[model samples]
Target: MLRFLNCRCLLLAGLLLLAPTVQAARTILIFGDSLSAGYGIRQDAAWPALLAKRLHEKSLDYNVVNASISGETTSGGRARIDAALSRYSPQVVVLALGANDGLRGLPLAQLRDNLTAIVASAQSRKARVLLVGQRVPPNYGAYAIGFHDVFGAVARARKAALVDFLLDGVATQPKLFQADNLHPTAEAQPLLLDNVWRGLAPLLE
Candidate 1:
């Protein structure tokens, strides 16, 4: 009886050990820019880091990879996407680029094309994409409007989920913005995570 009971306990332990491995966790990749990179903040204080914490709180099994680089443009994102995709093999990719392109006055057409290619590449790898939009400073004039439209257009064309503006809540709010008035303050990280979670939670389900 003792031997039989020991065997049963071992079997239960084996099952327990296999449970988490049997179900692979989903991975979400944030392919973005300075805003997403936590520019002046500690790495753990970034929105992506907060997002991972949020996921944990909700008991979701996911790996959030922040591949954001400060000053990265749509073209830069497109160039490095293949490597990111290969390394992360994410189930979802948050495409949040193009702001730098607009800042530099790069042709909107080129920006559009770069984003389109990035989306297509992710899709080809069977990854669902969430396009995160941005608004250029008003000084860019009509170009700012055009820049803002690019994300929606691409999302519509590709049938991807669109987060109209990644900085929706903090953009105009002085307290939420950092000294440079570009990136959000660390205190606003949760709200930023909330914005992303609203669009991302459904995809996980």
Candidate 2:
């Protein structure tokens, strides 16, 4: 009987010792567009999933919640920001939108305003924000430049972490993109995650 009691106590103590690690797991909310939604590839092959795997490998204890959708714009993300924030209560909110807006030639000012609102909302909730920048082809000229500039402007004003361009290494490689030429191929997911990790790692710490 004494042996049984000692064994139970040891088990309880062990569990207690392990409890903090389990409870310390925080969430990272990835809010973005098609690039992050894993557009033409399997969901597990997307950067968000890759990020989760990397975090686990590094023993970071972060839960990555990817709330991305194909063709989503900044206004669309703004509309849903509140609900997402309330639902996830994330420790870090990765704001990666505005690509579709630039592609569609939406007003750069509108894009900036919407993105600013999203960042402000996330920050208000005490979630750290990582603003992922994007760029359009030079053909759009001034519109493209203005659109690309929004990411940095918003990040600077809000004091969020900035990933200057999500497609840094992949953009130059045609094979890294899907046939549509906009979304990334499965092979490019890790590269995308790497770009994001450079900005996100500091926040995780």
- Record all residue pairs in model 1 with backbone atoms less than 3 Å apart, i.e. clashing: none
- Output the lDDT of residue 46, model 2: 84
lDDT per residue as tens, model 2, 1-205: 0000000111110000111235446888889877787766777788888888788788887787888766778898899999989987889999988887887788888999999999999999999999999887777789877888889999999899999998888777877777666668899999999999999999986
- Every candidate's lDDT: 0.76, 0.79
lDDT of 1 by residue, 123-196 (tens): 99999989988777787789989988998999999988888877776776777766655567799888877788
Error of 2 at 80 (Å): 0.3
Q: Provide TM-scores for the models.
A: 0.86, 0.87
Q: Give the TM-score of candidate 2.
A: 0.87
* Candidate 2: worst-modelled 10 consecutive residues by lDDT: 1-10
**Candidate 1: which stretches are off by over 4 Å?**
1-24
